[model samples]
Target: MDSSDREVRDVNNILFGGFTELFCLFLFLVSAFFPNSLLAGDLVEQWTGKHTRIAWVQDQGNGLDTYGRSPDLMLYGYDSQDGRGARPLLTQKSNFFKPLITP
Candidate 1:
């Protein structure tokens, strides 16, 4: 194409790219500024008598031998009369706790 046509194409490309970037930035800003609608309703409804489970693995230090650590899963439930209580449901000791890597 001619010089003018190339310049026009370049300008169009730059404009389109800038528009896309601005649109994405606007969407990000909107989401950041607005509280999450899904979680904004009620605090009591979110945690009242609800059960939460967490799965994790631990590590142990031993010499000349190794052991397989079991998967630890814990369930947490909140009760109004139970007061604030925290407990470690499961624990294991293994080297896998640090430098997590997949086999």
Candidate 2:
């Protein structure tokens, strides 16, 4: 019916939607509020559990890790790139929807 009835229905809709939105926001922001929580750790737990290792690499500020036990026990992230890092070129000027350049 009337204008007052429509306004009350709209207010009910907003109140219900506001509570749902607040719940979703709480779920999204719980991690930021509590930095030490493990909410998504299970997503990677299986892979990390299978490949994780517990070893000590001796570091004495000499620019080298002394995992000198065996050659197969080499460390990672130390392979140099000759000072020029990875530079990827984007070959696609546009996607299926829109062009990347406006001009």
Candidate 3:
């Protein structure tokens, strides 16, 4: 209606939208840590498919440059590029999307 009313509405909209987004993000991060133990065997099998093990590698040090120094278990049959046998390297990138350039 009035200018002041419109401004109030805009502010409320922004606040509510930001809160909703932050809430959703929090839920997503929390869910990531909480494994679905109730998941059925068939469902889990379907998602896992041929791959049985999923290995996650985290950077021990800070900074992007530390990525090179990160532990590489490729020699242990956990490499996507040089992956051998039944289990492949289960990096975060490979799990979600196919790598553009793999060795």
The most accurate candidate by lDDT is 3
lDDT minimum window of 10 residues, candidate 1: 73-82
Candidate 1 clashing pairs, residues 3+ apart or interchain = 59-93, 59-94, 60-93, 60-94
Higher-ranked by TM-score: 1 or 2: 1
For model 3, name the residue pairs that clash. none
Return the top candidate by TM-score: 3
Judge candidate 2 at residue 89 and give its lDDT: 26
- Per-model C-alpha lDDT, please? 0.35, 0.33, 0.36
- The Cα error of candidate 2 at residue 41, in Å, is 12
TM-score of 3: 0.26
- Where does candidate 2 clash, by residue pair? none
- Candidate 3, which segments miss by more than 4 Å at Cα? 1-42, 70-103
lDDT of 2 by residue, 1-103 (tens): 6797688668857866586456334433542443333432222234334322121222223434222322222222110112211112232222222112211
Tens-digit per-residue lDDT, 1-103, candidate 3 = 6797688668867867686456334433433443333232233345435323323233333534222334432211222122232233444321222123222
Provide the lowest-lDDT 10-residue window in model 2. 77-86
RMSD of 1: 19.2
Per-candidate alpha-carbon RMSD to the true structure? 19.2, 23.3, 14.4
